[model samples]
Each structure stands twice: as C-alpha cells, then as structure tokens.
Target: MKIVFLIAAMMATGLIDSAVAAPKSSKQRCEIVKKKIRDIESRMRAGYSASQGIRLEQRLRELKKDRYRYCR
Candidate 1:
C-alpha cells in the first residue's frame, strides 16, 4: 500500500538523520572533554600542589583516552 511505503520511507529518513547527527554530537562532546583537560593542565601549571596536580593529570589522561576511543 502507498501508506505502508510512506511509513517505511519516513522511518528510513529518520534513521539517516539520526546517523548524521550522532557524529556531530560525538565530536562536540570530545571537544568539550579536551577543553576540560586543557583547563586542568593549566591549573596544574598554575602552582597547584603536587597531590592535586597528580590527580588532575590522571583525570586528563583518562579524558584523552576516552577522546581517542570515542571521537577518533
């Protein structure tokens, strides 16, 4: 039926749209995480204590790993 064909076409288009949008959202999330890592690094360089610096560095490494795994 024409109605069935129309419904199928709409579902396919919706899937395509979602597929296109997913990468953009993922890339944006990765950039946000990178920015957070940079902020943490800057704070570390701004004379934070050794313990705090180490903790922040560890978190930065985790973020970098996530970025590599998810973004690229």
Candidate 2:
C-alpha cells in the first residue's frame, strides 16, 4: 500500500518521466551509428584493454548491421 502511494506521488510530481520516443529518420540513425563507432575508436585509442576494445568492435559491427538494415 505504501509503495503504491509512493509511486503515485512520484508520478504526480513528475519525478519519473515516461519514455516517449519518435522513430528515427535514416539520417539520424546513420549519425548515431557513426558517433558510436567514433566513440569506440576513441576509447580504443585511450588505452581500453584488448578484450574491451574487441567487445566495442563487436558492438560497432552490430550497429553497422543495424544501419544497413534500417538506414539503407
């Protein structure tokens, strides 16, 4: 009962905002993927461990795949 009241109060006060998102345009998706790749590259250059770099590269590949699927 207390938890329910607390949650209701929080929502009324706008302490927890709902996530309302619009679909991304192709350009926006491409830019986001490019930014993520650049971030991974920068982190690699900044001395991320080999394993961490590899994982980032894997994530980059996945992002690229998403870009190809959705942006192109």
Candidate of highest TM-score: 1
Residues 7-65, candidate 2: write the lDDT tens digits: 78545533333465644687876776666666666666778677756766787688779
Query: What overall lDDT, based on C-alpha atoms, would model 2 receive against the true structure?
Result: 0.65
Alpha-carbon lDDT, every model: 0.63, 0.65
Instruction: Give the poorly placed runs of model 2, Cα more than 4 Å off.
Output: 1-23
Colliding pairs, model 2: none
Per-residue CA lDDT of model 1 for 37-58, tens digit only, reads 6766666677767775676668
Query: Following a full C-alpha superposition, what root-mean-square deviation does model 2 have from the true structure?
Result: 10.4
**In model 1, where do residues sit more than 4 Å from their true spots?**
1-24
